[model samples]
Target: MDLEPPLSYGHGICRPRGFAKDPLVKTVPAIEALHPEMTEWRRDFHRHPELSFEETRTAGLVAQRLRDFGLDPVEGIGKTGVAAVIDSGKPGPSLALRADMDALPMDDRGGKDWHSHTAGVAHTCGHDGHTAALLGVARHLAAHPPASGRVVLIFQPAEENGLGARAMIDDGLLDRFPFDEVYAFHNMPLLAPGQAGVRTGPTLNGYIVWEIAVEGVGGHGAAFFKATDPLQAAARLAAEISSIVGRYLDPAESGLITVCSLQAGHSHNVIPAHATLSGTMRALKPEVMELLYQRLETACRGVAELTGCTIACKRLAEVPPCVNAPEGADRAAAACAEVLGEGAVIRDHPPFPFTDDFALFLEAAPGAYLFLGQESAMCHNPAYDFDDALLPVAASIFTTLVRQRLGYAGTHARSVAPPST
Candidate 1:
């Protein structure tokens, strides 16, 4: 097999040539040619990461890029979300592609030259890369207009706290950009590069973050029965919290509950009057999550009764399970296979333990969530970085979905013309 010389651009992106010879790989050559631009956009986003609902700069840049691609973008849909459309001017079903745009409220230690400049915000979850890839798709679609149907591009905010999708929906996103189906992707380090994971039904879990407060009287440390100890009550509740899933849920069903943070005393000699515990519970089903909540309340009540303290439990945030529509999942798998070869698309993988707000989009319309393989530390890790190589790979998969599902007539595949020197 002869390999063509690597394509080099001004920004130093060298893509391996000769993809046409491989029968299974159908990645768009034009998208691959846009690698340098995408890399620049991605790194720019990385350097200026923003927290949820505060993506003014990121949204502005994304809107400007969409405009540069010759598409009209509507900004501020979900406070800081942006949406644009590319219509083929023919009658067919509408498709929506979404990308998240918020960064975690954490410090970046990735050590890259383009690492986050924001003091307390970073794109540790690869939202920066997701936005850039989708922007590439926007440019490609604008250049090579689809022959029929509408392709909606959505850049959403606040996904880190699982509120972006709902925010958009509440802001009439579905009504304004009405799509028959939606699609999104997240980068995963668990799989090898050049691979994609697509699973039908229950691709990611639903979760709820909860907090419990235990109140008791403050007393001297040496006193035996002078006062009730809230710290001891909080500790007992924390220990019992882990047992709720195993005791209430079925042996085969998946459930989780963990006490992540506990606060009570500030000194060593005095017993504090108040103790608080916070954690999360997750399940693949809504009813199971509710069950876990009920069990948690029961545990708190029991501990309060046993330790003579007043206990209160509260649910902070809730995101439902992300179950993929069968048809959408099949189409996504085929599209990924087109870009990464048949063997690179995995369909037998188990549901991921993480949660995504995209689940809400699936509830509103039929769609699928996919995982793009990458070589890096897992997302949310301080040292994590997004792989630039997957930029074209993901864009091609999204583009293939448009070409395959929304047919393009009379347009032969053409290589992208390099920018004028």
Candidate 2:
């Protein structure tokens, strides 16, 4: 939902938070200069949290900051997304770096100084830190322009609901700001702060949100024999759906099916005519996900026949698994190794069950999605906050990627060309 800021809420730049350096990670020397400001911007974003496609304030701030950094930012893309380009005068393969810009629809009980001011909204997934880090990248790249190729900065909205990346792509994002390679990262609480996780293939699972409906006769609770209880049918279907992962999936493969919600009659004395069941199914492989969906439908049919009820299943949303291209993954690992050392670059982590719409972008271009470690509460947890320490580390890695791909170097900086409108 769209929640506007108060009139007193100004878009002026936030004061630097003076974030301390992390001893374990060797961040880029150049990014260290912007650490405090990046933390401040991140906290500012956390304080004024916005949800899903309703990131007007966040987008406005991003566009304004990009302009301040001397880059022209296009607004209203994907409804509330923002993008800016830093063109290097010389001709070379262009690179795009992206960050999501939406907050979760939950309470901010973290009790931090910069806790979310809006009710029922919070930056629980570290998107605030991602946005702030990308902004820092923009500021750094604007000043230090790439050695040859251009860099496109994307501030995408609605990633939480798995729509932002597709939204931008459907709005001709790729055509408008074309790039040969793309890259994005999400903060992970599973590893130590500043450590990087990069897997060669299937970094994230594909998922489908599904709903099931069961129809039967309704009657008073007292009339037990006469009533055809849809709730019982729905309950059986839920149990059957839960078993699909274990019963149908291959032993070597991993998948998940969860029944998150079930709704039936409102009154305790009555049996409802209809019942609804909804949940999600996730798998690392597209074929596996398809198999799971097939099994789910089969289970529904069998449950319907056994209970003498009409059952129908509907798919709400689907996202393909995020597989990192070999070239992109290698570059990401090298970049991480350059910034955080080789030992900190993890390559053995299994595919995450979580889904990101960034999968759509990976499908469009050769790129990778890496996870930067943070020593904090798990993502989506109310207590989670993006480690300010990661600001410099993440920005450093993005900068190093440009240097590695586009031939940019800190020693010989080029004069930045004027940003185009």
TM-score of each: 0.89, 0.89
Clashes of each: 0, 0
lDDT of 2 at 319: 84
State the C-alpha lDDT per candidate.
0.86, 0.85
lDDT of 2: 0.85
Residue-wise C-alpha lDDT for candidate 1, range 197-222, written one tens digit per residue: 89999988898999998999988999
Candidate 2: where are CA atoms >4 Å away?
1-24, 222-228, 409-421
Candidate 2: deviation at residue 383, Å?
1.6
Q: Report the error of model 2 at residue 107, Å.
A: 1.6
**Please, what are the lDDT tens digits per residue for candidate 2 over residues 1-421?**
1112112211212212222243435566778779889999999999999999999999999999999999999999999999999998889988999999999989988889999999999999999999999999999889888779799899999998888888898999999999889999998766556567888989888889999989999999999579788999999888888888778888999788889999999999999999999998887889999999999899889988887889999998888899999999999999998776677787767666688888888898899999887777778888888888888888988988988899874565433222223
